[model samples]
Target: MMMVIVSYDVKTSDPDGAKRLRHIAKICQNYGVRVQNSVFECLVDTANLELLKEKLLDQIDETKDSLYFFNIGKKYHHKIEKFGSKDVIDLDGPIIF
Candidate 1:
């Protein structure tokens, strides 16, 4: 699987904008983990990545919102650096309830 960093900026001045923001977040959550308020770290294959992109694009308003996807490839462990209080989740590790 490849690592994908997804980020978005949604126009939240109205009710619809807020709804859209939630919808976008929900979609991302289905595919990965949220590292920040509007950033997510997703580990998926090429086909799933394309599907994620399409879903995100459909939720965004092109004129008012913006979305980004940074493909970090398979060798992504050393590419990322984090210095914060929140613990990072290993995408390749086992999941526990």
Candidate 2:
């Protein structure tokens, strides 16, 4: 499968920038994308990556902000490595004393 990682870096203040970022992230998520911080990563098996790029570009326009995205071109060799990583805390386990 083909995996994509897009690191977005836009020049704007925290609040406005973050708001736009969140809006774009939502668009990506709506397209079945897996996001991490400003990075949007997802795995798919297709002859090309056009669909993915299109979704991201739409997000850029949706937020009325500039954005950057590209395919990291890393392949998911196996299922054990996991698909994507995020900043979420591990809520499945118990806390230690």
Candidate 3:
């Protein structure tokens, strides 16, 4: 699996824009963890990444909104540096319920 950093900005001056923003966040939640207000860290294969991109694209308006995807590849542990309160999750590690 590859790590993908997804970020977006939605024009939220109106109700439609606000709705779209929420929809976008919901979509991202299904695929990964939210690291910030509008940023997500997703670990997915090529096909799943494509699918996520498609879903995000569909929720955004080309003229008013913007979306970005940064593929961090398989070796991502060293590339990221975090100095904050929330601890980062190991996407490749076992899930503890």
What are the Cα lDDT values of the candidates?
0.97, 0.53, 0.95
Q: What tens digits encode model 1's per-residue C-alpha lDDT throughout 8-55?
A: 999999999999999999999999999999999999999999999999
* Candidate 3 lDDT for residue 68: 96
Clashing pairs in 2: none
- Give the clashing residue pairs of candidate 3, or none: none
Q: Name the candidate that leads on lDDT.
A: 1
Model 2 TM: 0.47
Query: 1-97 in candidate 2: lDDT tens per residue?
Result: 5565556655456677676667667766644345555665555545445676676565553444665555544543332234455443222235354
C-alpha-based local distance difference test score of model 1: 0.97
Pairwise lDDT winner, candidates 1 and 2: 1
* Per-residue lDDT over 1-97 for candidate 3, one digit per residue giving the tens place of the 0 to 100 score: 9999999999999999999999999999999999999999999999999999999999999999999999999998899999989888888888696
CA error at residue 87 for candidate 3, angstroms: 1.6
